[model samples]
Target chain A: MRIGVVTFPGSLDDVDAQRAVRVAGGDPVALWHGDHDLQGVDAVVLPGGFSYGDYLRCGAIARFAPVMSEVVDAAHHGLPVLGICNGFQILCESHLLPGALVRNDHQRFVCRDQRLRIEDATSAWTGSYAAGQEIVVPLKNGEGGYVADEATLDALEGEGHVVARYLGGNPNGSLRDIAGIRNAAGNVVGLMPHPEHAVEDLCGPGTDGLGFFTSALRALVG
Target chain B: MARVVVDVMLKPEILDPQGKAVHGALPRLGFGGISDVRQGKRFELEVEGEVTEERLAEVRQIAETLLSNPVIEDYAVRVEQ
Candidate 1:
């Protein structure tokens, strides 16, 4: 399977995401923000970063990037896309997912091994995990608080669209402790935590996040 | 050239940490009695042509689509003399 990792000008985790894809037995493709072509990859990963210097808002400028128009269209057509951190912000900005990520309620950058529970494991990016399973991954960001209206929140919860929920404690004051969420179709998922960072036991807290990449491979192959 | 200003603010329901931080430091610095503070962004756009009602509407569209995120923010647009 081939997975594409998009690198925006300020992307910080594109290489790591590609490595994770390779580690999961998938060929990794490097994609550019300035190019509109997707290179015909089966899956797309928007790595974490301060894209376009995070000007105006996090992921705001990148949302209008030449490549993003292609991503938005591909995502709607059932192309599996996983967005991490700033990638998640971009997905929300692109309207591929619901809600927004605001500045941390504490007004500071937070970097830690965050515990998350797999709330919905049936999504394209999370099928390798079992529902209700807990995993720890690196979570780092200044603007990571997730928020939405009551109706939308209730709908997300009621429809099983929430992919992950924070475990142990709410790190950034995200509503309902939502760490990640998937679109209604379950093909596009937006996660604040860095699953790519946790794919290796040597450099990461553990190999708890490898399932995300492997799940995409499985979704593509199976 | 005419200048159009757009003020973008987080919706009342959303928390503004930067704004709250400023609000927190006020009383400590003896600037008291202010109940709250909310920080927002102001964008000024320079139009090359005359500022017509149509242009103002276009600016409003820009404010709605680019200057602010409707999901979490509200924006006001006006032409400055």
Candidate 2:
């Protein structure tokens, strides 16, 4: 399987996402922000970083990147897409997912190993994990708080669209401790944590995050 | 040419930590009785054509789509003399 990782001007984790794809036994393709083409990859990953210097808003300007047009189209067509950290902010900004990520409620940047419980493991990017499984991944960001209207939050919960929930504590004060969520079609996922950082045990807290990449591969190949 | 100003702000229900921080600091700096401080964004757009109903509508669309996220924000647009 081939996974495409897009690099925006300020993307800091595209390389790490590519490495994670390779670790999961998939070919990693490099896609550029200015390009509208997806390079024919089976899936796409929007890596974390302060795109466009986090100006205007986090992920606000990056959502207008040329590549995002293609990503939005492909994602709606059932192409598996995962957005991590700032990437998640972009996804929400692009309207691929509901809600918005505002500044951390504590008004500070936070970085630490965050524990997340798998709420729904049936999505394209989470199929490898068992329901209720807890995994620790690096969570780092200033604008990581998730917020939406009560109706939207209720809908997301009622439909079981929440993919992961913070286990130990709400690091960024996200509503209901929502760490990650999947689209209604289950093709797109947006999460605040940095899964790519936890793909290897030597460089990270553990190898628990490899499952996200592997799960995408399985969904594409199957 | 006319300059169009767009002010975007988070909805009242959403939490504004920056605004809260500013509100807290005002009293410490000897500015009292300031009940609230809501931080927001301002966009100045230059339009080459005359400001008409059509132009204002277009600017409104831009404000809704790009200048502010409707999910958590509210925006108002106006032409500046």
Candidate 3:
């Protein structure tokens, strides 16, 4: 399968995301933020980084990039989109995903190997893993909080949209220890952790994140 | 001329360290009345005409692009004519 990774001006994790896609036995395409085209890729990734220097607000500027218009349209049609960190920020800004990410409650940037429970591996982006399976990946962000109203939160929980829950402890104080979530259709996912950085043993965390990439692959094949 | 006020706040998912720090310090300052505090921003813009849906949407796009982070914050727009 072919997967596209978008590169915004300040995207720091595009390379890692591409590497992970390759490691998952898929071809990776590099996409530019200013371009409104998806290059016909089956799946797309909004990689992590301080887009536009996190100016005005993190993920705020990049959410209006020309490319995201296409990403949003594609995502609505059941095209799989996975957003990591700042990428997740863009998704929320665009309203593709519900809720927002705020700064860490501790008033400092937090970085660590975060453990996450795969709450629903049946989603399009997480089909390879068993439900309730736990995996560890790197989490680094000054703004990684996830928030929504009580009613919305309950709906997400009831609809099986809360894709992952934080394990070990809440790294960024996300509501209810949520680490990731899927759209109602389960084709789109937004996660605060850097799974791409953990897909290899040569550096960073172990290959626990390989499941996410491989899971997307399975979704494509099936 | 019409005026619109936009209030942007971080969604509950994100941690507001700044808000928490202030909340933590308020008790030491002999003012323990504050229960919760979150820091966000507000925007005021003037528009040329009536606040149509299209105009509001354009402004929303501008706010999303220039004023707020959707990942961490939610924004509300209020207009007065």
Candidate 4:
């Protein structure tokens, strides 16, 4: 399967994202932020980074990139999109997902391996795992807190859109211990963690992050 | 002319590390009496001319659909006298 990884200005993890796709045995394509076209890829990833220097709020400016227009369109048409870290911020900023990321409650950037339980593994990007399976991925960000109103939180829980939850102590004080979520359509996924960085065993962690890419590949071919 | 104040905050379910850190620091800073501190963003807009309620409404919509994320934060608006 062919997966497209978008690179916006200040996107620090695009190359790592593309490499992760390759490691998952899918063809990786590099997409530009200024281009609105998808280049006919089966899936897309918005890699992590401090886009637009995190000015005016993280992911706020990058959400307006031309590539998001295509990402939004493709996500609606059932194409899978996975956004990591700052990419998750962009996803929320673009309204692809339903929330925002704010500064860490600790007021400092937290970087470490975070344990997350696969809450809903049926989404296109998570189908490889069983619900409640635990995996560890790198989490690094100053603005990684997840928030929403009580009613919307109820809706997310009621609909089972919550994809991943913190397994250990809450890393960033995310409400309900939420670490990730998928869109209502189940095609788009966003998480404020660095899964790409953990895709290789040589990277000082387990390769559990590779499942996300492989899951997307299988979903695309299926 | 008219104006508005916009306030945005992280949802209760989401952790507020900034707030938590500040709360944690109260004891170290010798402010043990303080119990909690939550950090948020405040925006004030100075609107001109038309001064219609619709204009204020439009600004709020922009804040939600564009300016802020409804999932992670909530926004509040108040009209100027």
| TM (chain A) per model | 0.99, 0.99, 0.98, 0.98
Per-residue alpha-carbon lDDT of model 2 for A64-125, expressed as tens digits?
99999999999989999999998999999999999999999999999998899989999999
lDDT of 1 by residue, B1-81 (tens): 999999999999999999999999998999988999999999989999899999999999998888899999999888889
Predicted model 4 interface RMSD: 3.0
Task: Indicate which candidate wins on TM-score.
Answer: 1
Clashes of 1: 0
Q: Kindly list the per-residue Cα lDDT of model 3 for residues A51-150, writing each as its tens digit.
A: 9998876787898899999999999999999999998888888889898787776667998988889999878778888898888889999988788778
Q: Give the higher-lDDT candidate: 3 or 4.
A: 3
Give the clashing pairs for model 1. none
Residue-level lDDT of model 4, residues A56-142, one tens digit each, is: 689888988888888888888999999999889988888888867777766778989889999999999899999989999888988
Report iRMS values in order.
0.5, 0.7, 3.3, 3.0
Best by DockQ: 1
Candidate 4 deviant stretches above 4 angstroms? B1-61, B70-81
Q: Local error of candidate 2 at B74, Å?
A: 0.5
Docking class of 2: high
Better of 1 and 3 by DockQ: 1
Q: State the DockQ of every prediction.
A: 0.95, 0.85, 0.51, 0.51
Better of 1 and 3 by TM-score: 1
Q: For candidate 4, what is the DockQ?
A: 0.51
